[model samples]
Target chain A: MIDHFALSQAFGLLFASFEPWLWVVPGLLIGLIFGSIPGLQISMAMAVFLPVTFGMDFLQAMLFLTSIFTGGAYGGGVTAILMNIPGSSSSIATAFDGYPMARQGKHNEALGLGLAASVVGAFVGYVLLLLLINPLAALVLKVGPMEMVVVVLWGLTLIATLNDSSLSKGLLAGFFGLMLSQIGMSTTGVMRTSVGNPHLLDGISVVPAMIGIFAASELLRLRGSAYLVQDEAQRDIAFSRILRGVGETFRYPGVLVRGSLIGAVIGAIPGVGSSVANLVSYGEARRTSRTPEIFGKGAPEGVIAAESANSSSEGGSMTALLALGIPGGAATAVLLAAFSFHNIVGGPSFIRNQTEVVYSIILGNLGQVLLLAVIGLLMLRVLGMVVRVPLAYLVPSVLAMCAWGGYGITGTVAGPLTVAAFAALGWLMRRNDYPVAATVIGLLLGRMMEGELVRTLQISNGQPFNYLFERPMALALFVFMLMVLVGAPLLKALRRRKLQQAGR
Target chain B: MTTRFPATHAALLGVVLAISGFILWSAVSASTSLNNLVVVAPVAAVLGVLLPVILASALRKPAREDVGSGAWGDLLLLAGFSAFCLALTHVGFDVATFVFVWAGVVMSGGRGLWQPPLYAAVFTVVLVKGFGSLFPYPMLTLVF
Candidate 1:
């Protein structure tokens, strides 16, 4: 599985040439800007730059596209930490605590911590991917409907952990989100919740709705305020604080390792990429923390977990994309298109014949990760000044951008309308202390969960117990999910016992 | 949080219950399969009715501080964006962009009569031209 000769060739291909660098810089910039914007997306960035790579070679095109992927993945965390808004869906969990930290005048620290985690995640993900590309693809193929259902269930458990006020309320918010997500057409071609609007045939666009709930709602709530940070004295950008935040990422080795692994595995799973990986990792981090209640409030660990997982997923997604020709989500889908355009087919045959080429692409991305760190630091200093902008200017500007961004996605009035509706709904929910994050996550995973469950039912021929009995992996996954559900309290008790012994 | 809403209880419950019931009705009506009728339809009802009750119960009767004058800004937001959406489709992206941002700023209590317009024009041109050059397709075809 470990191909050293190809690795050498890959190194030679990257370090030996200067052609790929031409597009890498621009692609990264586009990714960073697009990814950091509230309503703009990484996929949209890639799609925009996709045509620019037409005349380039396979390696150049991949390098350029992957650089955008790398930059955008980290770029989202910047907005997430500074504003309560996530630049993209993958960074939603990043906002949970990052915004709270920002409220307390820790914006620089949040961005730094996010940057450090993203770099580490991208680094580890690519390194592991380089070594385990084939094995990772093999692992993805083994995942069946039952496994996907378990994954969705695992994702739902995070919702329970996110409710700050009441557990039932959290579950309710999550369930509400699930219902909201189900509004469009179902996998079975059944229209479940469109409310007679033909524009909602695809349901609400996730990014637009996210913009509404997180960005627009916050803007609405802070109507009288001048800026995001309420206190005027703490509004200035501090480089020292940002650097300290970078240094502080080392304090949570446990979060980084766990989050990165979760991201890689979830990201590699076709159709469930960074979107679920970041949220699932954040949920798990919150569930296992010594101070679980502080997660959505201002825990630096939450930002680490979410950003690390999402950034790492890029590498995990690539493992499948290069080895098995599978695009895990929107970003990788574009990558897969690049592969086809270059006449560079993927799958077993490509791996067997073009191992060196695959290695080169991986090597290129690893370098992109390193470049993103240097680039991210400089940009953070400049971008961190957004906190100083007055709300009157900031809010309306964001609103306009958000509306335009939604228009870019749906090309219809419905996109912006959906954003408006979600914004109002989210504002009401927020006012009442509802778990807005849970609602968003639930809406995201609803269709996915339903499709997987439907497939599981069809596979079992309605004999679900029998189906579970037959598959060892499914049974194991079910038990793991059960353990995840039960282990939190057990671990808490164990920690308490340890504390008692130490006190004695 | 205090409830400044005159009919906070009525409004909140009414909205949640009303939306839930509508969605449940739609799901059941559209559902032709057994899985949908048995599993999906029932789940929709529970989600609509049971959960909102849980949420409502989880909350107090509605605090006196629950609503604020800031909430009026929400209406302003809605109205501004609503007009923007319609204007972009009908008037033109450039014209709509200038108007939307200008109106949105003023509505949100932004000062400076000339500054808002200046910002809007520059933003519109930059966005239109920048995106227009990036890809092969026309980004603001309505404007051109």
Candidate 2:
């Protein structure tokens, strides 16, 4: 079952590619800076620098980008911990406990724990990519349209678990996002709601919309703030303490294992990213914890759970991308495009035909994880200094970057304008306490769901109920969805009743 | 105990429901071909929009006080800003961008007239001339 020759070749290629570590380090450093900075995403950084890799070998170019991805992901946690602001959407879950830990004067501990968890989680994900991705790819090859629909629905059900505020609110936001997605053309060769604009033919670009909603809105919110104070402090963190933090993470093996598994599963489902994985894992950890009340109050365990799951999604996500040629998240989508540009065909055949290349990628990812850990620890001392920069200066620079990045998406001013519009909408939604993730979920899943639903209907001759009922996987998914919708509330009620009875 | 729903929530929910109902009605009416508008559209439409609106109306009440102020002004400002940006595209990217940035800075609460003028000039000279040559095309197309 195992091909030793291919594996050896992969390792050889990986080792031989070390000369480009020169470019890799600088690229990672740049990615780290961008990731730590609010409004500058890894994609923007990669896109801006993609031209530099034009003359390099294909594998070298990929290694450089993957290094950036690995570094950027870890970099996002720096701002999240030191400042209240999350540097990226993936880091939002990190902020819940990480920021509180910082305010409580456990800044070094928080940073150490986050970095360690991120590196380990990424390693675990990379291992899965190496060992299981090929087999998974074989399975995915047999998936039909019906199976794809089930996968999409499974991904969408994640929104139910993302927002703890209210199910109705989250669902509503997701549905609204779906509706926004419908503003373009349908797969059926008909325009549903373009309102006669020729530009509407291609549908709204998710990147511009995401940039507008997350980055631009964040800038507007920071507009009137006085200078952002970078919190630079001289805290001596011992090597033993960092090791102990890593040890403490594994001490809660249940949490680590569960979080990793959740990340892997959620990562395999398209459109769901680290954000959803972090939320669900954190929620699950809270649900099962002996001291659930300690969550959101600088619990190191909480921080570990969230960060570990969040990073592990990267691993699970790559599995999906390489195996199915279906990207699990936006970053992976960019990676897919890069693969296409390199003339590397992804999918089930990738494992069989290009096993060496795939294994090389896996090995590269392992190297990236190790590099991120060492680099992150070294930068930890400086990040505390970086976070002290004033919000006033930071805000304008971020806004400018967002404006330029949005414009770069479509090479037009309209992209920036869309960013502004979405910013206003996001701000309003935040004010109303609606979950922004829900809207993004809707936007991401809307078109896929519609197309799948339409195709499923056509196959069954307008008999929707029969199709869902007849298909075993679809039926199971629907049942799973219902259970998820009801599970949280039921558990809460049961817990409350048990407490009431004990008191009486 | 007494329970009262807020008028704002009621109004918002009512609007959402109306919109969903209109879409559903349109879908049903527009179904000339069996494959065109099927049960999925209506089901998804009703489930996604109408259910949420109804749930929102049933579950929560709006606050008595108007929470968000300067609402009308903010909308007007946004509209005006968008219109101005669109208008700037015809004058070429450098000139338009300089004006756009300057105007944005001013509107964001910069006080001095000299600041806008100075920034505009600098942006034209540095950003327009310097950065413009670096990119592939003119920077001011309408993205939509």
Predictions in order: lDDT: 0.80, 0.65
RMSD of each: 2.6, 6.0
Output the TM-score of candidate 1: 0.94
Q: Count clashing residue pairs in model 1.
A: 10
Query: Can you write out model 2's per-residue Cα lDDT over B87-140, one digit (the tens) per residue?
Result: 545655555555555655565555586866676556556644544434444565
What residue pairs clash in candidate 1, if any at all? Answer: A226-A391, B2-B63, B2-B64, B2-B65, B2-B66, B3-B63, B3-B64, B3-B65, B3-B66, B4-B67
What ranges in model 2 sit over 4 Å off? A1-9, A20-22, A33-59, A72-114, A145-151, A154-171, A227-256, A269-310, A320-357, A377-389, A459-504, B1-64, B67-138, B141-144
Q: What TM-score is obtained for chain B in each of the predicted models?
A: 0.71, 0.52
Most TM-score-accurate candidate: 1
lDDT of 1 at B34: 61
Q: What shift in Å separates residue A61 of candidate 2 from its native position after superposition? A: 3.8
Quote the positional error of residue A244 for candidate 1 in Å: 1.0
Which candidate should be chosen as best, given DockQ against the real structure? 1
